[model samples]
Target: MVEIEYKNARVKLGDPDLVYEPAEDSFLLADAALEDTESGMRILEVGTGSGFVSAVLRANFENVRIIATEINPHAARCAKKNGVEVLRTDLFRGIKPRSPEARFDLILFNPPYLPTSEEEKVPVWLNYAFDGGASGRETLERFFAEVRAYLRPGGRILVLISSITGVEAVQEKMEGLGFDVDIAGRTKVSFEELVVVRGKLS
Candidate 1:
């Protein structure tokens, strides 16, 4: 296990080669989450790779319930080791709310937003971390389709997307889904600007 510290939180990565390592995007999302989260809120994090972002949230919040989902087995284990409650399943597949109150107050996702083609695909679990299927919004699109059912009334969503992933397009999609969407955070990296899209149920 590889351990690293960020924002006063320590995270363990099971296998660096197999699990997605925390990078600039991860830290950016964590910062954004910290700003929006409150005490006693329920939060769900999708694809919690090294559990970095969720761990950061838990370390800083009081009475906050956080659950995470990861499709990669290695990543799921890594997140567990980092003290995150993680489900080993695809996005929202294993999560079913028993009632309206069971829904989350906030949902967070730092999806794989790389535009990758078939020929660039790797035949390993790591591919799930970065393969966004040609348009860099495939998994993101899937998440938007199912998120509303799991979110409470007036709940919020914080998602990280890159400039190359089509930020405006993502905002438009969220608006169409009945979310009052806006850019909550932004940072320019080497080649792309990462944006945190915040959406409130409307």
Candidate 2:
């Protein structure tokens, strides 16, 4: 297991080779989410690799309930080790709110936004962390389709998208889905800019 500290929180990465390690995109999303997080809020983090973001929030907020989902078993284990409540399941597959009251106040996702070709794919579980299919929006499209159902009325969503993944396209898609969308934060990386897209129920 590997441990790293961020925003005063210590996170562990169990089997980094198998799980997605926290990187620039991860830190960007965490900082953006922290700007909007409030005490006593219920938050759900989809695809919480290594639980870095959620762990940061947990350490910084009091009375905040955070739950995370991960498709990778290794990631789920790593998140659990980092003191996050995580479920090992595909996006939203295992989360079924018993009532509207159980819905989350905020939802966050840092999806795999790389435009990966079949030839570029790896033969390990880590592929799920960086494989966004040919368009780099396949998994994100899936998330947009189902996320609203799990969010409470007026709840917010914060998602990270790279310029290579078509940030404007993502913002337009979210708007078309009945959200008031805007760019929350952005940072330029080596080859592309990472942006945090904030969407609110309209």
Please, what are the lDDT tens digits per residue for candidate 1 over residues 25-69? 999999999999999899999999989999999889869999999
The runs of at least 3 residues in candidate 2 whose Cα sits more than 4 Å from the true structure, single-residue gaps closed, are: none
Q: What local lDDT score does residue 118 receive in model 1, on the 0 to 100 scale?
A: 97
Largest lDDT belongs to which candidate?
A: 1
Consecutive 10-residue window with the lowest summed lDDT within model 1: 94-103
Pick out the ten consecutive residues of candidate 2 with the lowest summed lDDT: 93-102
Which residue pairs show backbone clashes in model 1? none
TM-score of each model, in listed order: 0.98, 0.97
Model 2 Cα RMSD, 1 decimal: 1.0
lDDT values of the candidates? 0.94, 0.93
